[model samples]
Target: MIEERNPTNTWIVDDDSIYVYGLKKLISIKGINTNLSHFINGQEGINALKKANENQQLPDIILLDINMPVMDGWEFMNEFAKLKPQLGKNITVYIVTPSLDLNDIHRAKSIPEVAEYIFKPVKISQLTEIFSQTQYQTNERIRQYGT
Candidate 1:
């Protein structure tokens, strides 16, 4: 019997529509099973996260961009930190940006919630590794928590 895998709930919080479109296409081409939600900026992402938290339907992974209009990634991280303790499940956040600033990289590294910092124009290999890790972690969590 083949074991069925659940789709990963994923979010892309970014202002660039073109980038989002490309990323979605890449994900589809890779045959990754993901239920993706897109937010134009950090504020929208935060609001959606709040609603998701209330409904206990939080995303499993977040690909966040650094620069946005309403709220930047740093600001969003601040808000996320405050709201995290109330969340029912763990969410892995990746900093996906074009910025090559060392400060930004260091900042992301400093944050405990950030899993990794990825450069823009994300590669297929990186996506594969990330989803594979996500699946492994999800399976491990299920084995341990039965949830």
Candidate 2:
């Protein structure tokens, strides 16, 4: 397991239990040692995000699923747009969906809030790569901007 030098909180908003289990394992192995929050659907995830924001404990990253029982990912994004400014935090959102439809991919790409669209059954290597790039970018920003 790779060790996390700079901790980050991750939120997974997916309904599939098996996928969630596998993702949790992968995240652990990839060494995201901070807290992980799970939400069954988009609505729940949104609500939790709002609550967490109120507590000043917003997650750093969110892994969102597209299809769900109530309030799909698209709907959540709509609501999130309104709530985002109020949250007072920068949260990176990744659309982690099983859907391979072109329209879905296009829609996710169109959203400025979405960092990336990832295929289902996320790979450990992908996570590592993403984290590494994110870490590098963050360091660069800090060096340039004095954060």
Candidate 3:
């Protein structure tokens, strides 16, 4: 789900065409966030972040897919963490994927950028959890500089 506390600007990323289509539809039909954006892969997602940063600010939260090609969530998180010192804002990230493997969960937890790891199929409750974390961090963006 995309970030939307009140009039939000957020994004969702996934490589699976059907998954993307379903998520976009589910998000919209469920009234998730009309202001939300979508991306096919981690590269596109990260590029969008760079562009957004240049324009105003990056997304407040990101629903990142773990197993995309070329640049997966693991790679995305690596690059995103590099921007933490320069962006000057803590952008909350949630790892959303269908992988239920213990290794995936353990690896995701190892990354400081990943606020949470949620397995698919995605649910409204999952979005609520991500929003909760986003709310907590958005309220203290300055305090999470090291994050």
Candidate 4:
């Protein structure tokens, strides 16, 4: 039997409603229990993150979209850079975009907070792997420090 993974607080920051719903469903279908939150744009996402941080309820992972109407992913990242230190917790962020532009990929890679740059229509296995890796990392940290 597969080991049940720990539930994660996951945030989806994208302008596309259909993509958001589909992604959420895929996450659930993979049996990766998640307390999910959605934001239609980067500004909204940043605001939510700030509130969550204030309550000490920041998400474990954030799926970020590059292109949006207001405050695109890059803009959000710029703001996030300023807010990150105040957050007091390490939150992993993945850049999810359909763009195959090398510049975009390079830019994302340059950012330290971006854990991975995923192409459009993220696969179930990819998400599972991410969860598994995160779980393993968490377990290791706990084992080492008893946190």
Candidate 5:
């Protein structure tokens, strides 16, 4: 018998509506099973994180943008670091930005929570790989921990 898996919970924390729209389209085209959610700014993302934590429904992955109107990605990282201990689940964070600054890349790498730094216009292949790995990890955790 084949075992069915739940859709991966994913969040995009970006203020660029166009970018978000395109990313969502790509995910849709790829036919990835993800419970996707979007936040316009870092503050909104943080608020959603708090609520998700309370409900024990935290996202499995987050795509974060550096430049936003309220609370940049760095600020959100700070808040996330503080709240992370309370969240029972592991959430992989990827810094997705248009900025080509070396400092930004270095900063993202330095953050322990950040899994990778991806440039703008993410490809369908990348999304496929990410979701595949995330699903594998989630399945492993469930197998081992029965969570």
Candidate 6:
């Protein structure tokens, strides 16, 4: 078993059990110590994010799965946008999907909050890349957007 951390987060939104297992496995294998949180759908993720926002501690990262049962990643982003300046600098979202569809990739590329569109069966390398990208991007955003 992996040791859980406090402050609620590096998060994931996915309905599939196997993917969740694999993701958790990756996090553990990579020695990621952040609080690992998950939600079955985007709505739940949004609710948690909202609560976190109100509490002044949104997640460090959000791994969003595209094809979910209710309220998909796009919807989550839309909902998040309406939250009245709740999310701070560290809250970044990444689209994690098994699909190789070009349209999906294109769409992911278009979204600003979406830091990157990562392929599923997500590897250690991808995780490392994501970490680097997110760190750089977040810092740039904080600089440009101010906090």
Q: Pairing residues by index, what is the TM-score of model 3?
A: 0.79
lDDT of 6 by residue, 35-84 (tens): 67889999999888878877866777889999888798888878866763
The C-alpha stretches of model 5 lying farther than 4 A from their native spots are: none
- The TM-score values for the models, in the order shown, are 0.95, 0.85, 0.79, 0.89, 0.96, 0.79
Candidate 6 TM-score versus the reference? 0.79
- Superposing all C-alpha atoms, what RMSD in Å does each candidate have to the true structure? 1.1, 3.4, 5.2, 2.3, 1.0, 5.5
lDDT of 2 at 135: 65
* Candidate 3 global lDDT: 0.76
State the weakest 10-residue window (summed lDDT) of model 2. Answer: 1-10
Once model 3 is optimally superposed onto the true structure by TM-score, how far is the C-alpha of residue 113 displaced, in angstroms?
0.8
- Candidate 4 per-residue lDDT, tens place, 17-133, comes to 999999878877777767889999999999998998889888878899999988999999999999999995678999999999999999999999899999988887888888777
Model 6: how large is the Cα RMSD against the reference? 5.5
Model 5, range 1-147, lDDT digits (tens) per residue?
776787899999999999989988888887888988999999999999999988988999999999998899999999999998999889999999988999999999999999999998887778899999999998889888888
Score residue 22 of candidate 4 by CA lDDT: 94
Worst ten in a row by lDDT for model 4: 1-10
Which has the better lDDT: candidate 2, or candidate 4? Answer: 4
Which scores higher on TM-score, 1 or 3? 1
**lDDT of residue 124 for candidate 2:** 80
